[model samples]
Target: MPRHGRLHIPGGCYHVMGRGLERRRIFYADADKQDFLDRLGETLARNGSQCVAWSVMTNHYHLLIRVGDQPLAKLMAPLLGGYAGHYNRRHHRSGYVFQNRYKSILCDADAYLLELVRYIHLNPLRAAMVKNLTDLDRYPWTGHSALMGHRKQDWQSVSEVLGLFARGLGTARRRYREFVVQGLEERDSDELLGGGLVRSYGGWEGLKRLRKEHVYCIGDERILGDSDFVERALAQDTLKVEQATQRIQAGWDLDRLIRRVSQYCGIKEEQLTQKARGNDLSLAKALICLWGSQELKLSLREIAHRLSISQPAASQWVNRGRKFCRELGIEFEVIDS
Candidate 1:
């Protein structure tokens, strides 16, 4: 069967896994692991992605990432390619160091964010690299140490992960450690690893619910979420493609988008960042959000930064923009393919 197209929505959360070729060791020593991580950090920053959780095992590695402007594929290519070349030259080895393609599951952040963090952090114990939680805490190959305040991987977003637990960092770390300990006794999470509804919703329980309700579950191996989320994600993915095509036809980039929206609304582009109470300004901002997200595929966080507003506000503007477009029958300007 043909492979499914990669899912690349900005601000999306994903669980990405890659393995060494034939299950061979990717990291032969601490130096190798360090080298891989250094490359990973550089690649993530360069691509505008953020790492929520990650584990570097001997033969495989896992990453929980939130995509920004760049697609996940773009971010991973250089990281893996660069690391592979370095590994081969240093060890006097040859051929592919990693599997041809990595597996990435676009996940529903609200449902599996913390669960994934715990699952990924526990890989050392699951792989028998560490004997216990204490050892796992001190283990350098995983983001668990960073979460536990044991070691610092400055690129890892520990505060964002911990913020899910509690408002205060001290209290959050304590709760986070307890959560990790609890995850140790749970069965290995095959669902989080891959698949659709069964994997997305944490297994057969979800499948049974869909069956009982006689509801068709929209699912794919590349995505993890409830039927509604799956439907929304698929719909948005289609919108991204369509809008991207429209953008190409219009030859619109960020600068062009800002100019077009500003001119249409008869407002100065400089005024977009101001908190004015005019309806036209609101429309212009809404258009900016819609175009930025649908046409540019930018993350809400990135949009917020550019607009000098909070992420929530950016999200609200996006919603309003969608509503405005719907009301006005303003679909992206279609062009002949």
Candidate 2:
């Protein structure tokens, strides 16, 4: 069967995992790992995303990221692509570095944030990369050391993770450590990995019990959440799909969108395509970028070409446009079909 399209919800938290091609080692030395981390830090910083927990193993890596306005793909593309290029060049090897597109599970933060933190940080110990929790505290590859105050990573959201445990920094760290210790006995958790109905219900036994009780819960492989959360997310996604379809069927092409935005913003259509900077122009361009991609199903490359701007700039505008529309109560009126 074909894979499901990645579900992109702005500001959602995701548990992301990537493995090396053919189950080979992605990192051969400390330098390789350091390169990957450096790239990740830069990518997260530029994209305004937060990494609460991360672990880099020999063949794979995991990240718990709370995304900002842009889709998660914007952040992952550069990080994974840059690292893969760097790895291939340094090793004098060619071809793909990663097994495939990295896996990402949109998690219900309230339910799985702390659990995922513990699971990701404890990866080193589970793989025997570190002898024990004490060693894991000092282990450099995982974010555990940073949380434990044994190592410093300016990029990792140490405070955010610790803040969840306690108000005071020191007390929070202590409590966080205790929490990690308590989770050491947990075997590989399939529920944390994400799945459809079976994993969402907890396991086979949980499913059986629910079935016996005549209880039904919605689930999706792309999402890790309770029935309500899954239903809400799916509903939102369906609405977006329907809206996009309506826009396309209504003849919402790039030219028509540009003309409409220009008319709404009270600017000449030509001004939007020109290199200019002003509040009105910026907002107009942002709307074009946002609506063009979301409603008209235009790619960033296509949007950038139309606006005469770089692809990266187009992405930034999409994020800005989202915030602008939300804060200012801006809405686009559909043109007559």
Candidate 3:
């Protein structure tokens, strides 16, 4: 099968899983788990991400992460590489540690965040690494202990997860534990693991219902969400690709992109290019920055120089521009190309 491209959306949540090669044990000792967590913490901090839930198992691991400024690839590269090197050197062995690539499923956070949290935290207990919920709470390798206040994990986003269950911290923790306890009866959740339409719609019956209702969804092994969410996510990606191709084929340059953006925003090129401070001017500049950097694949330094702004300022504009375009439902077309 062909490899699926990773769907990278900033501020997206992902359920990421990776396993050791040949399904061998990845964490041989307590120190190895700690080393992996430490590396994870550092990488997440550097990449500006938060771990909603996580657990280290004998042969594999699971992470629920809300993507930050950087792409998920940037976050995983250093993490897996550093940990593998550490593990190998410590064990006096040298070979491939992890399997091919990690499985990353772009998830609907609102739908699956709590479920994934419970599913991931209970991995240790389910794997016979712990006896019961009490033991799982203090298992030390899972985020469950941290959420229960039995362990301290400065890196984990405990407050946000607990905040979903209740208002008070104590009550929230109690309720969260009860919620997890209820799921103990759940058999292996193959749906949570990833299948195409079947998993996306919740099950085969749900998928059949959708077909019966004439509701078709864009499903992928890389995404888990509702039809609307999947469609929008894919549409956004398609827009990016089409825009890039159109701009490239039209032989667009910085000047042409700025002119087009200015016209679309009903502003003048001078007002957009010159140093101005207003919503309109900012919006125009942001659009220009996004087009120049993303579609044109121009460097931030180049865009900054063209706009007479600092590199940092141009970079900020690019981010804002993406949001602006998304909000405005803006799409670059080949009307005049």
Candidate 4:
């Protein structure tokens, strides 16, 4: 069966997982894990995303991220690709590093944020990589150490996670530790992993209960939430797709997009297509690249060719342009002639 497209909701939280190819070790040493974390930190900063919780196992890793305006792929592609490339070069080997595309589940933060955080942090302990909560507290491979005040990761959203527990930092840390300890006896659940009807309804028992009550609800493998939340998420995604389609149908071609972006950035249209770089010119090109790919559904190669830049450069511009547009409150609208 064909895979479904990822749900890209701005400001949404996700539980992301990636495994090494054939379940082999992705991080052969402490240095490898640190390298991956470094890339992750930089990626999160660049994309304005947050790492609420993360755990780096030998063969796999998990991240709970709250994305900014740009899509999760924007942050993930560079991080994963850069790390894979580094690993290959350092290990004197080549081929696919990861199993496949990383799995991400759009979570209902209000319902599952804290639970997910605890689940992620406890991974090391559950896997016997650490002896117990004490060992887990100081385990450098996960965000647990940072939250416990034993270590610091500037990229981890320490305060955000702590704040959910208490108004005061000290009290919050105490309560959060207590919460983590409470989860020690609980087995890993599919509900946390996320998927369609069974997982969404909290396993087969929950689904059977709903069935007996004659309650029918929506569920998607891409989302982790109640039926109402799932319905709303699907609706929002549908609306966005429809809007993009309408813009394309309304003749929002690359040339028109460039002209529009150039007009908005107060730069000449020719400047955007040139190799020169200036604040205004760069902004215009970035906007054009971003909108061309997103609104016009043009490929990065095409956008790069038109802007006199390489595909990689165009990808970077898309991210920069997304940040710029969000900061400037700019929206792409097709102006009728």
- Using TM-score as the measure, the top candidate is 1
Off by over 4 Å in 3: 1-4, 195-221, 240-337
Query: lDDT at 19 for candidate 2?
Result: 94
Query: For residues 204-312, could you state the per-residue lDDT of candidate 2 as single tens digits?
Result: 4576589789996544345676443454455454564445567678777888888888877789987877765788898899888877765565666677778887554
Off by over 4 Å in 2: 1-4, 197-221, 238-337
Clashing pairs in 4: none
lDDT of 3 by residue, 204-282 (tens): 4577688789987544445665443454455454464434555567788887888777776778777755766777888
Assess every candidate by TM-score. Answer: 0.65, 0.64, 0.64, 0.65
Which regions of candidate 4 are displaced past 4 Å?
1-3, 197-221, 240-337
Candidate 1 lDDT over 1-32, as tens digits, reads 44455767788898999999999999999999
lDDT of each: 0.78, 0.79, 0.78, 0.80
| Candidate whose lDDT is highest | 4
How does residue 319 of candidate 3 score in lDDT? Answer: 60
**Candidate 3 clashes between residue pairs 3 or more apart in a chain or in different chains:** none
- The residue pairs that clash in candidate 1, if any, are none
lDDT per residue for candidate 4 within 117-169, as digits (tens), equals 99999999999998889989899999999999999999999998887666688
- Residue pairs in clash, model 2: none
Model 2 per-residue lDDT at 76: 94
> Which 10 successive residues of model 3 have the least lDDT summed?
195-204
Q: Which RMSD values do the candidates have, in order?
A: 10.8, 15.3, 12.9, 16.5
